[model samples]
Target chain A: MPTVKFTQALKRFFPGLQNMQAGGKTLAAILDEMEGHFPGIRRYLLDEQGRLRKHVNIFIDGALIKDKTHLTDPFNDNSEIYILQALSGG
Target chain B: MKTTLLLGTRKGFIAYEYRHGAWQSANLSFEGQPVSIAYADPRNGTWWAALDHGHWGVKLHRSRDRGRNWQEVAAPAYPEGAEVKDGQPASTRYIWSMAHGGIQYPSRLWAGTDPGGLFVSEDEGNSFELVTSLWDHPSRKEFWMGGGRDLPGIHSIVVDPRNENHVHIGISCAGVFETTDAGKTWNVRNHGLRANFLPDPSTDVGHDPHILVAAPGNPDHLWQQNHCGIFRSVNGARQWEDVGQPGGPAWFGFAIAVADDNPLQAWVAPANSDETRTAINGALCICRTDDGGRSWQEQRHGLPQSNCFDIVYRHALTSSGHGVAFGTTTGNLFFSPDKGEHWQVVNNYLPMIHSVQFAD
Candidate 1:
């Protein structure tokens, strides 16, 4: 199981799921698991065309994942995944 | 001559007494939480502070007695779940930027915000009405949000001092926009800017122009600190060239100041963050350029270099007759008498000092 953590701002939208444990081997699988727990969370993550929303960022570790659309980054056992609302401030 | 310092803090705003040879903080509560931008209207003797806090939301606070007391002009309320006709919300995320129109129209105030929106207050900052004409423009539909959390939030709103009709705005990751027709249309004006990390032309070019400053005397002269490097525009961003690296530690700070007495004079303080690296042991020094950003010199006569734990936020740098002043995240304030050299910590132990402006 990998752990997904949400930032303080996103907590308003997804309540009680501050940090969730997801069963997945890859980034897409983890999101699929997230959708199962909190529906429409994935919609805010993606846009009308199904592309990742411009403001959502998914990081496997500290490095930014390049595959924003499909997120093919691999996940290890006990891997730490973070879903941030992307700080859009200057 | 006398100097008045307006300090915009996260909690609220404070006025400083610079008459007896030192700066003293005069606390007031025009803001509910943290404040980001404070503009002093010298024409009508009004001080304006822009607020950005959670739950309390965004609004404006005005001071007529030079910060002795304050009043809030309630921000327009958007319906609970009303989406903007263009598919966004009316208020967006928060009020991120505010600017006085120009010396000619001192009563005019312009504001920009997150997600992506623009508004103007015609009646002396009493209230603001969204400029739906610009938001509802056909091109706005294609206006892509900068594609990440560090994406498009309106951060820079610059009004041409020479021409009131010409306006320039910088969005978080969306680069720079200009309107020649007052508010009729806007064009993405990014020519010599670059985003070295992102290999795409669209994304890399406009990823966060943190500060875009136009020369107070010459509207055509401008300077900026974006995601990549420090840039200068001689013809109002029509042409630009790299000026300097945000020198000193690996830091990215927002807040740029230019001297009103000298058009070619400018200063920038580098911080530790997303942009680039400063020296490992570098103190937060104000980098100055007297030749219109063509060359640079570092000024650190009096500043913290050992336990240098301060980050200057946007809209913090301000200059006037007394000198150039800026506040830090560590609650320490610094002022320079001869531009950037020979600084002093005039005030210490205040709340997070977000902005500092010298006026009246």
Candidate 2:
């Protein structure tokens, strides 16, 4: 099982978002699991093409994900996943 | 003057209500999001907000109870395998404009987006499908290039009041397009327009009309604040004639407002020029034409006299009844109760306003 966490900013739209443990081997699988828990949360993270949004970032075990387009960045069952927004510009 | 004014801004969506003889902040929604468009459908009084999220993609929300409650709906999307150019995939980038279908079709909506796609919703915006006739037009791939942004965007959608089937749209670097058969077919409506930025200034498809507006009293009469100058067409945009002051501040501007009651009357906010998009001579002013553009009156009273740097976007200027209002890129809003004769500051501080509409 992998533990997943979210940025506090996402709580504005998804009120029930919380840190939880999930069973998944890949980043996309974990996102699918998150979507099962949060119906509309997938669109907020990925675009219609299933690519990571330009201003959103994902981390696996404190390292940035390798692939943004395919979300193929590998993760282990016990790895920690973090989703955060890139707030660089005003 | 209308009772309510809706504003879509860089920071949020705000509404001001005129009550007890003064305009006051009535409500604020999407307080931290970039509301690209705040539209109030005249047919049903439903307010729609087009949010442009920096982290997330564009989203649409509607409020039937006037901001008291909201319902999030799916924004328009490009079908699978849709491509903007040969190798680039197409997706809804930014929603630049939105318009209601009309009274005839109560459950209709139109949306214009960046990367040059027009979306129509026949079910009151529950879902939207791309108008592929215009998207797959022959000239779109070759002549449609970006104006200021990286990709070409459609910023204006004019739904004719008399007949809902007839509509007009303005595209940056792509010229005006008209549809008479309800999006089944589209024709280029860029005759008598100039595109100085192009190598050939008289090209048929590359002209950029910054803002296109149709008079409410007479749909045949149209006005556009072009990148080169001000233009007007009395024959329903079949041909455009340059009507801007040759040596005046009205020569270059982005926003134009036509009075709803009088087809011959209109207002435009004057900017410095294309090179420097600021207030003319550091003084904020609006120009009004009452004699069908034969002459223009510069309305400068009750505005900043000097030391100003404000540029009005196309969607930030509006006119209805005897009222006219404009919002600036520098967060300044001005309103006139008597057809631009005199102005008053509605709010000195606000976010960069993207759209302004006078709604009841």
Best by DockQ: 2
lDDT of each model, Cα atoms only?
0.68, 0.91
Superposed model 1: Cα runs more than 4 Å off: A1-90, B30-32, B76-92, B103-107, B137-151, B201-205, B246-252, B273-282
Each prediction's number of clashing residue pairs = 14, 0
Predictions in order: chain A TM-score = 0.84, 0.94
- Taking the tens digit of each residue's C-alpha lDDT, what string does model 1 give over B173-228? 66777897666778777788876656675442345677788877777878787666
**Model 2, B336: alpha-carbon shift in Å?**
0.6
What's the residue-level lDDT of B127 in candidate 1? 70
| CAPRI quality band, candidate 2 | medium
RMSD of each: 11.0, 1.1
- Would you give me the overall lDDT of model 1? 0.68
lDDT of 2 by residue, B156-186 (tens): 9999988999999999979889999899999
